[model samples]
Target: MTSTKTSLLGLTRAELESFAVALGEPSYRGRQLYLWIYGRRARSFEEMTDLPEPLRRRLDAAASLDRLSLVRDTTAPDGARKLLLEMSDGLRIESVYLPDSPGNTVCISSQVGCALGCAFCATGKMGFYRNLTAGEIVDQVIEVERLTGARLTNVVLMGMGEPLHNYDNVVKALHLLSDPKGIAISRSRITVSTVGITPMIERWCSDDPPAKLAISLHATTDERRASIMPVARAYPLDDLMKSLRRLAHVTRYHVTFEYIMIAGLNDRREDATNLKTLLRNIPVKVNLIRLHPTGSDLQPSSDNAIARFLDWLRQEGIRCTLRESRGVENSAACGMLFAQEPIRPSSTQRRTLDTDD
Candidate 1:
């Protein structure tokens, strides 16, 4: 029978110390347990060979190492892998890993489902379920690390849900990852992307560690932005830009701007010029992303159209890069992290996708 004890995955070093004290053990035992669980990647108290048998048995009966249960694992031909992780409460989330020369990058979700309802996102269409606990978020990295048999160098909280919406848990997860006794990933390596939550971004700018920030600024104007990203109605583009400027000064990190081009909608020379003016004062690197076809009426901007926009930005002296599309085969690319089968694209949609380079 499995133990009904509390999960050890959520406890911090101090909390672990307290647990050790409660277990009638020395304070150092908590530190040892912390290292064993996160540092050495022990999945059970019995796996901790350093501890005494009785104490290990006691911990075994009192605390659980049970974390996320792997549900479905799919890999794209390009080597991008997406994992569907099941939380203790049966809520499911998706985490994707993208490989590059530097190291592996894990894109982890913060919520079960998303409420943002961005017109192009599959996860958003699933509707909001619940926010994931801090332990749930941290366990994703641990499980992914264990599965891949290698260290994950970079992490981005831009998977299935709006991370800033689940502020506290996401922040807690950040600290947990930075814990030297645990995952020990550098602050600079983690990127927390948001769809422009003003208050949260301001709070992050002031209080949070120096994690790289990225804003999903798909549209240059407020009217157009609000159509796709409903959050724009709550936090207008003007206000969001102000917070981003403050963020640039506070973090001194060049914020990355993610812009997905939809043909005939946000793809135009004028849009690029407007985007340039909007981010002119902010220290940012613009990433031009091709929209992943998701059975939506929206068409990704053509390759020529993307080139034209990049050219316009370059002419305007803005730092930018047209991001290469990844994981299109297994449907693990950006905005494609869905637990359910996506709606089939129409015949017209298929033709448009086939033309994409």
Candidate 2:
């Protein structure tokens, strides 16, 4: 059951200290709470062995270490696991855990659903529900790590929502996730995928973004792009490219462009040439992604078409990789996350907590 107390999951060390001080405890108690909550991954105050019994009770009364409830767990044949997590309001979001050799990666959602309405994405079809608090976003990583019993080496904000749309919360989540006193995951290990929000990209670059930026550039031209991704209509291709070029100049990291190959939509020889020209001066690595089934009429690009596109990019001195679809059988791949069976909440008002609050 969801707790009414303030959630401690998303609070930073300083914020946690402040919270402790508010409860008539020493500021160091907050540091202890940070270690217990993030380092020890404690689910309840009772599990905080170092904390005094009375203090534990006091913490339990004022703060909650709440986590999203795992509603459904599905694993694809390729060993990728999809987790459907239910929020306090019963709105569910999906996260994907891709287990690999030396490291594991979890793709987490930043919103209950997406508003972008991308033609090939399943999440976009659900329409926008609400923006996930920083706590909700961070918990997806903690919960996935707990459920899988595998330490996550990488985190991707590429699961269900357009992360940039929920800018404040997403940035807050990034701070908490990369804090050395807590999860301590390096900034380089994190990747945020956006559908090219030009203003957000420029802002993120100016602020010295922690994680690498990946732009979803499925089509070469603005007309074809806007046809598939509605957000493209607001921030056109030219403006988006200008931002990326600026980003290339500022950040040392290579900006990866994710191009989804649909059957006959944007997988032509002309498209490849245009794409090369568009990304001519930008420092980018292109990932030619095969279309994952989203229960839409759209189909994946032909293998020959994918090969030709790859060849064209390589011939033009562009760095490109052909990413074959993974976890497709169970709809756990890219563009396939949709919480089909979300539980409805009761009449009680849902409580949301954040560090800034």
Candidate 3:
């Protein structure tokens, strides 16, 4: 089988220029191609009208512009759309486009499946398939833009896999998405969510990338967190807090803690107080997410419970917001994205085993 060449969509401007020059095309061709791919949202080489047919053929021969195939699309009653995208390798992932006041927000997946076994996540049940290439990640946005006819103002890496687990590709995708000559979305508008992988967090803080950071911190205490999320055992709350402190000191942006309200689990006033203490000195905002029913062992916390928790936080002067669950009818809720088909086995395959929780 002939493998497709590297895509131009994932390349930096310098890299794109190098590729164009190597192809015997002028340097300016890179900018034109970039605009064609991103600005015009062209899917085929034929859409690049200004380029000569021979050059277009050369480009087609050299690299593939295609990355994802839209396998299924479902629109929620609330107007949210979820897409199940099949990669070239036959691995499946999901992306969601949600309408907001000013613009739309696209929630993109970074991997085929998830490695972090968060108790309440349906995608976690699917297990880790593979990390998405930068081109595949960028393609999700391009496809969403095509469907909606509006530029994506906000991007959240809170889909199928842990963004920190697939750090390199996720970073590459961010650079591609935020490139001025490409999508040009502000880094401030992009948020990368992680399950608190300590080393990567430390590295990210030290390197200081422009995008915002969000930690999936369902519990404040290590023991309780470990009970719900297996990742907590690897990177305990104390260690996670140390890394968060470094991130706070270095970056001006406020880190958001995603606290999923699971009914009869971690919904007490004491839990809220513990959360306040945990984030006491750190520059942070709390996003209270009501658990979406995934037919899992966990149940959603009641609205009254969520209100009580928010009331406590507000009274304590912590910046907090109750995030409304969108696309619940479409299985686009937090940690719910997974392809319906089976993944093809590979030599380097990693399986996701079922957990009791």
Please provide, for model 2 over 100-155, each residue's C-alpha lDDT reduced to its tens digit, 9 standing for 90 to 100. 92389999999877777789999877777778898899989999999999999999
> CA lDDT of 149 in candidate 2?
96
Alpha carbon lDDT of each predicted model: 0.83, 0.86, 0.83
Please identify model 2 stretches exceeding 4 Å from their true place.
1-4, 345-357
- TM-score, per-candidate, Cα-based: 0.92, 0.94, 0.93
- Give the least accurate 10-residue stretch of model 3, judged by summed lDDT: 348-357
What residue runs in model 3 are displaced by over 4 Å at the alpha carbon?
1-4, 342-357
Candidate 1 is scored at a TM of: 0.92
Q: Number of the top candidate by TM-score?
A: 2
Residue by residue across 114-199, what tens digits does model 1's lDDT show?
87778888887777767778888888999999887768999889898888888888888898888777898989999998888898
After the best TM-score superposition of candidate 2, give how far the Cα of residue 84 lies from its true spot, in angstroms.
1.0
> Which regions of candidate 1 fall more than 4 Å away from where they truly are?
1-4, 341-357
The RMSD of every model to the true structure, in order and in angstroms, is: 6.6, 4.0, 2.9
By how many angstroms RMSD does model 2 differ from the true structure?
4.0
